[model samples]
Target chain A: MFSSMTISQLRTLLRAREVSAEEVVISVFDQIDKVEGDIEAYVTLCRSEALVQAKRADALLKEGNAPDLCGIPIAIKDNISTAGLKTTCASRILDDYVPPFDATVVTKLKEAGVVIVGKTNLDEFALGSSTENSQFHVTRNPWDRSRVPGGSSGGSAAAVAAGEAIAALGSDTGGSIRQPAAFCGIVGLKPTYGLVSRYGLIPAAPSLDHVGPLTRDVRDAALVLQAIAGWDGKDPTSVQKELPNYEAVLSEDITGLVVGLPKELLDNELDPEAKEAIFGVANVLESLGARVEAISLPHAEYAMASFYLIASAEISSSLACFDGVRLGKRYGEAKDTTSMFMKTRGQLGIEAKRRILVGTAILQEDNYTTYFVKAQKVRTKIREDFQQAFGRCDVILSPTTPTPAFTLGHKLDRPVIMYKSDVYTSLANLAGIPALSVPCGYTEGGLPLGMQIMGKPFDEATVLKVGHLYEQQTASERRLPQKEVKANG
Target chain B: MELSLKEMEELALIARLYLTEEEKKILPQQISSILDMVHSLETVDTEDVEPTIYPITGSGVLREDEILPSLAVKDALANGPDIVDGYFRVPRIIEEEYES
Candidate 1:
């Protein structure tokens, strides 16, 4: 039960001395022992290290006046570096590569006194939509083991949903965080680009990458965001802006708030169940005194294509450092530098290689203007679309994903189908706005459906507030996937 | 646009990935389809629009010239596959020419 508690709930008990940090950690680890074999959410578990941190947190609690997250156990996606821990990014190339220093967010989390449980699995270099692309193993949907937990942050979302961790950090590049969080039936927030420092996140796409929180509820997301959202000199792209207190906005009313439902997103090939769930959210918002209206993002249809081109182009350049020279595993023997480069780079997984190859071709002089530059121009249009829509409404609402979690390996062979899963979610990344996925309802099959609330740049306060309001109204829909997991097992 | 096997091989070479025979057989079709998907970007009229390389609006940050303690050589070389004198060891870059 302690493992299943939210951060706010655990904080009360921890501050009151009713439950020690060590007890919470042990309970979480116990749950891990119960279902990790079937769920496969984590790539690495630091039980001894977590226990050590928990014991430290208990000591701090004895001193009184500790941080809100003090003693909370949280998971970090494998792509984010943790000092003295292996940060594999779920790729074999970096299996034994332990970081000598922590990522900027990891450093911030440590300062807040949260015990890091472990590194969760992800797609190789965070390249794919499903954890099946993970070099380690597939992370199954806790709601249905036969399905994926959505990725490349699948493990983080799954861990939080199944009570393996109270909350977790996941990086979003083209819905890596939101999609998985939606699939796993939890709240996931992708902060405005440059809001969180990306100094240590293994980059999938630098321009599009954002590090954010995936938690059991919207309040927990705000708490984690409070700890990690800031600028760092190490990350030049990080914006120097004063962050609003995200937790303060949670109780605010949405009486006159205008929520926009993009006509373009709804007109796409959406599942009937997902469409129904999206409309159901509109009704709920309207009942809360918020006005919902249909808005158009004319260039929205081109987001997916532009995102893939931009992301792949950036990924090709970003991953060039793994040439087996400075770090990471090098492949077979070679006589010369060219052959060595080729052999060492051959360690990339199929999807990674595919993206890199496509990226390479896109960046070629002949195709540069046709693909890469065109995608960037289209990206400008996408951002303009969001800007125009936001002028008419405070926030936009849409399905976090087109549908709930699909069966594993269903779209594995079809790259385009897998890419299509990100269509609705990637628009936020392309526009560099904040988007949060809160569980709105569930399908008849019992899988969760998520509705995304997107806000203007650096307006995370409004986004979190909207999500928190919806979450409070729909509290009954919040259920752990444990029973479903156990039944499937 | 469909790519030929030769084109796929060229891309693999540029990416520095060594594709196997089977990958060579399947990748061309896969890459071509992905290309076809992305080609939709061309349909949008972007004649005069400026490209967005970075999403944020501000100019790049420039720090003052200052000496800062950085990663230790031992720590930097800790994860290297092969190291010599605290430097990464790699295959020979310059090839030796021989008289025929």
Candidate 2:
């Protein structure tokens, strides 16, 4: 039912009585039922609860109580705490854990009348590049079931692409949302850090973590972001600022907008298909009258190393609170407390434990001065690099991921190789800039590739404007994931 | 740059996860390789640079202090791993040995 409509289109349909909210929610359920068995996209789907909300939305809209997201259905990445809903970060530790209260973003979305249909699967503790790291089972890509939907936000991307939901909320620690969006051929945005609140979001690397949106189109992404953006006192990182009308920016022309591309960032180690997709988008922009130039952000070369050290260190500390004594899984009915500690965490996936250990090592006093402190300086340099590059251009363009969706087990044996999968997207997180991933084309193997549009700090409007404009120019539009999931009803 | 067996075991204790000797053996190598990869920051110079421990940008976020009622006890305990007599309960702290 939503295979062809954007969020705005769905809102208009609800407003016009062309389709009741129940009908749309029911359609989403129908789609989920048809495809989830084959795709295994969800962790949990609240069919009865979702329908109840849908009926209420229909009633509320009928009574003129509709808000911005009235009747719109979305799936949330399970790591984000959703009150009364199971909010596992796809880790065995929190397999059955239910959050006590809604995260700030969830509260806002509910206030806006957005109905959550389900919680989707993800990499354990939001750690991996592919959904296969999930403790439960892998979420297959909608484009090719044999391949993975790039992850930690893979299931959120899958749910949106498979049409299980209209759009989804995803947390990007190090490119989780953007990589998955690129793999699924959907549009994903990693907003400037602090643009969205993190209170109630279970921390992975809290400082690096950002809540963002994944949608089938750019305008829908913008609509979703508008509702979720803004400061919340509940989130320590939330910023206070006036909210902008995101929808108003879709028509802002990008003609003559200086778009810079530093070849130093590209032209090396990227897959040919990925290169073609990026350059193709540049050609489109050039024809659209945007002046595209190449410049160098010299400090950019050292970013991947800096990103890993910082992210891993924080992951180690933030996850320390998950001892079985407080919440989540506790293992070893052993003779002592030390044993209990070992038993519980040993059950954690190798990847999760691996990061925790590495993070702790980096945070050590002996190493902190050499590794942690130095990474911070490198991070400052990386931001400086972007600042210098942005001086000459309004936005920076690149491939979101260097390759299309890889085979599920492609890099499982080599984790470092896998971390590089986030290369193009992580730089923005370091710079605290807004960057978006939009479908540029498909690889010869049929996997979707994405092109990234990065904006100056706190300037998400420009990213959306360029993405929506590019979307409007293309005749080809998003197709629902090949599999169809229908409600059990 | 990876974790040693001792380090992995230490981390397991801190994280409250148990690991067998075999896992301890396997994890050290696995963790070390990745650590070496992320440790590329050793090449950087951060002297005199302020460390960035947080991502939020801009000025004072200090909020006015005010007393507020807390959530009901039941609500607070809603997600606890285990409970007894309306309170979160855990095994007696093993202070005899391996005390932090």
Candidate 3:
């Protein structure tokens, strides 16, 4: 089906005039209409807007004045701003707040002539691992109707997996992209922090925030990354280095590449199936002439705690702007300034409130040195651990998440349990290294299993190379989850 | 150490959040447990360790001060709940603040 074709395939078809840009876009919207009731992937869909953009893209494609992603329909996580689109971040506070400017990545995507389908749902402010925290609605895993498509990028991942969009963009602070990509059985890359401009991405935790692509395959991820990764003067933290041609790296051989298996990540704590899947990928790499070895990263045990404390502290600082002042839905009668501000912020979701409160507590006068400073110091140790490990291996391999998608609402009440979902994935964010989750296989329950590959800073080429190689070598084709809902006649 | 209700309330105030009575009742335990989960970080010896703030090694750049067009007043006021005279109008702290 046109909807199931990868960006590269669709690009070839469009360039060859076998399928028009409008046809692909229309198929995508039709697919979205057929499946959206079952999987609530998007919060705001730009139907008419996308049709207009598709017409423009068709013109560009016909003129041969377009890039590889020209005429492709892609979804943006709600947190990424598109000018005049309501970028809610899946929170009520910004429900009606349309952005005046497109994010740097959005601008780049438009320049490439890609059609944006709409804003996908996310954990409110991209705070949770599950879209259950989204104020609008919960996005379900296409693999299992009752299960969560791992989040805070669950909507983006779900949309791509369900053929709602050919590919989508999601921002990862702590496994927001990778984990959901795993859950949805697709390719998700978290580029090295600062590789992508964060100018218009609503910040969850700036220090850890990264915007990357979620695609059905590794090559498509590379295509999207090529378009989006670059420095922007608007984002001072953006890397000033020259962009790598990710597409070129995909064709490179993996012979003699040393893949590291962190001993800590493979310990008895992992799900048996996930552990086997990682080892299975190792075997595939081994057959491909790549060597896999066990490596130690001792400080990784402290990653989850360090990430939460550090991320929460940064989130507290970044979210300080949404006090019904600059742009957000205001609540209650205007009493006094303090009360109005308090009531306005009272509209924040429970998860947002939890982070804000804990984050505020950590930054308090008495706790700053104890919690915030200590976490920052641990962060240095975590980065050092990766530095030392990468000294011996080209890339590290592990299960992207500890387990496949957990049943919906399983860990909702237990904040600690929910936080554990990102334990294996957050280490990359801590070290500011690049990581990608590629579908390894599936568990017995038919849910997706993900294999994670980590590379040294600015070495996304190697990471994508390894993932692309594995994706190419694996003989198994992805088994799409059986659809549970059918369109009414 | 688990936080008491008073401590949680203090945090809520610091966070500028207004919690419901049920939230006030449940949040202390929740926040206390999360704090407890992070308490394990103290076991790590971080003495004399320099904190890493920005992970990238490069120093911040100083851009040349150049004049650029700013956001249009209409776009700026587009999402505002209340606007007056091309500015976001908030509850008056002092009448002279918005007197134009």
Please state the error at residue B27 of candidate 1 in Å.
0.9
Tell me how each candidate scores on DockQ against the true complex: 0.76, 0.52, 0.68
Cα error, candidate 3, residue A124 (Å): 0.3
Per-residue lDDT of A120 in model 3: 96
- Looking at model 2, give its docking quality level: medium
Which consecutive 10 residues in model 2 chain A have the weakest lDDT in total?
A480-489
Q: What is candidate 2's lDDT per residue for A221-333, written digit by digit as tens?
A: 99989999987777777778787889898898888998888786686789988887778888888888899898787866677888888898888888878777767877658
A1-489 per-residue lDDT for model 3 (tens digits):
788789999999999988888999999999888888889999999999899998998888889768879999999999999998899999989988899999999999999889999899999999999999999899988878889999999999999998999999999999999999999998999998788999999999998999999998999999999999987888888877877789997898989999999999987878999999988999999998899999999998999999999999999889999988778888998767777788999998889999999899999899999999999999999999999999999999999999899999999999999999999999999999999999999888778899999999999999999998888888466666424334431
Going through the candidates in the order shown, the clash numbers are 0, 26, 0
Q: lDDT scores for all predictions?
A: 0.92, 0.83, 0.91
Model 1: residues >4 Å from true position, as ranges?
B97-100
Sliding window of 10 residues with minimal summed lDDT for model 1 chain A: A479-488
* Candidate whose TM-score is highest: 1
Ranking by TM-score: 1, 3, 2
- Compose the digit string of candidate 2's lDDT tens values, residues B1-100: 6466776777666566666667676788877877677656666666676766664476236677878776788877766777887887776774576657
